[model samples]
Target: MLKAGDKLPQFEGLNQDGETVRSEQLIGKKLVIFFYPQANTPTCTVEACNLSDNYSKLEKAGFQLLGISGDSVKKQKNFHSKFAFPYDLIADESHEILEKFGVWQEKTTFGKTYMGIVRTTFIFDEKGICERVIEKVTSKTAAEQILEA
Candidate 1:
């Protein structure tokens, strides 16, 4: 698992617009990469909106935000359009990114166990070194926590 001070693993993925987003592009900016299960769900919506609400602040603080999920580009595009989020939403349908970041895991809900992506966020500084890893994220407060980190 990634932790504070560890260099982030290099990655390349497509944004909501199907544009390329690479780790190299984030060379000199603080990055807040949050991983969620899917788009348009209750918790995911809350998390995305919460970050959207404070996007200006995060930008002002020199942070570039990105969200990743296993959802398709079409679904992500719709969610982005509806919420008007000014950040990148990467499509990770193959689960490669999820596995790379160690967010893919076996989870249990109401006595049923299954594999899924755990909601988590990684904070990386301009140097691409992780500054914080939020393992237990509350959708509403996630942005504030990243800001503080």
Candidate 2:
């Protein structure tokens, strides 16, 4: 898992709109890059919605948000539209960004183990340095976690 003070890894992925989003574009701004296990799931929805509900506060605090998941662009689009999120959700179906950010890992459920994304969020400072890493994310209070960090 990435920790505070680590440099943001170089990455690029397609957003829900199929537009290219690159880490370089966020270099000079504070950013909240959240990694969710899947889109539209109950917990994921709460998390995404929490952020959306508090988006104005986040923006006022000088931060932009991005959500990344292995869901396809169509699914991401649906999720985004369904929730009316004010931020972009990247379709990282290729897992390139997932691996780069170290969120891809072995997960177990119902006695089955498999590789999947661990719910995590990386907050970066204006210079692209990691400022905080939230690994034990509280979906219902995600935005508060970021704001109070």
Best by lDDT: 2
lDDT of 2 by residue, 78-144 (tens): 9999999999999998899999999999999999999999999999999999999999999999999
Runs in model 2 lying further than 4 Å from the true structure = none
- In order of appearance, the predictions have TM-scores of 0.96, 0.98
Candidate 1: misplaced stretches above 4 Å? Answer: none
- How many clashes in candidate 2? 0
True-structure RMSD for candidate 1? 0.9
Best by TM-score: 2
Model 1 TM-score, all chains together: 0.96
Worst 10 residues of 2 by lDDT: 21-30
Q: How accurate is candidate 1 locally (lDDT)?
A: 0.91
| Candidate 2 TM-score, true structure as reference | 0.98
In order, candidate lDDTs are: 0.91, 0.96
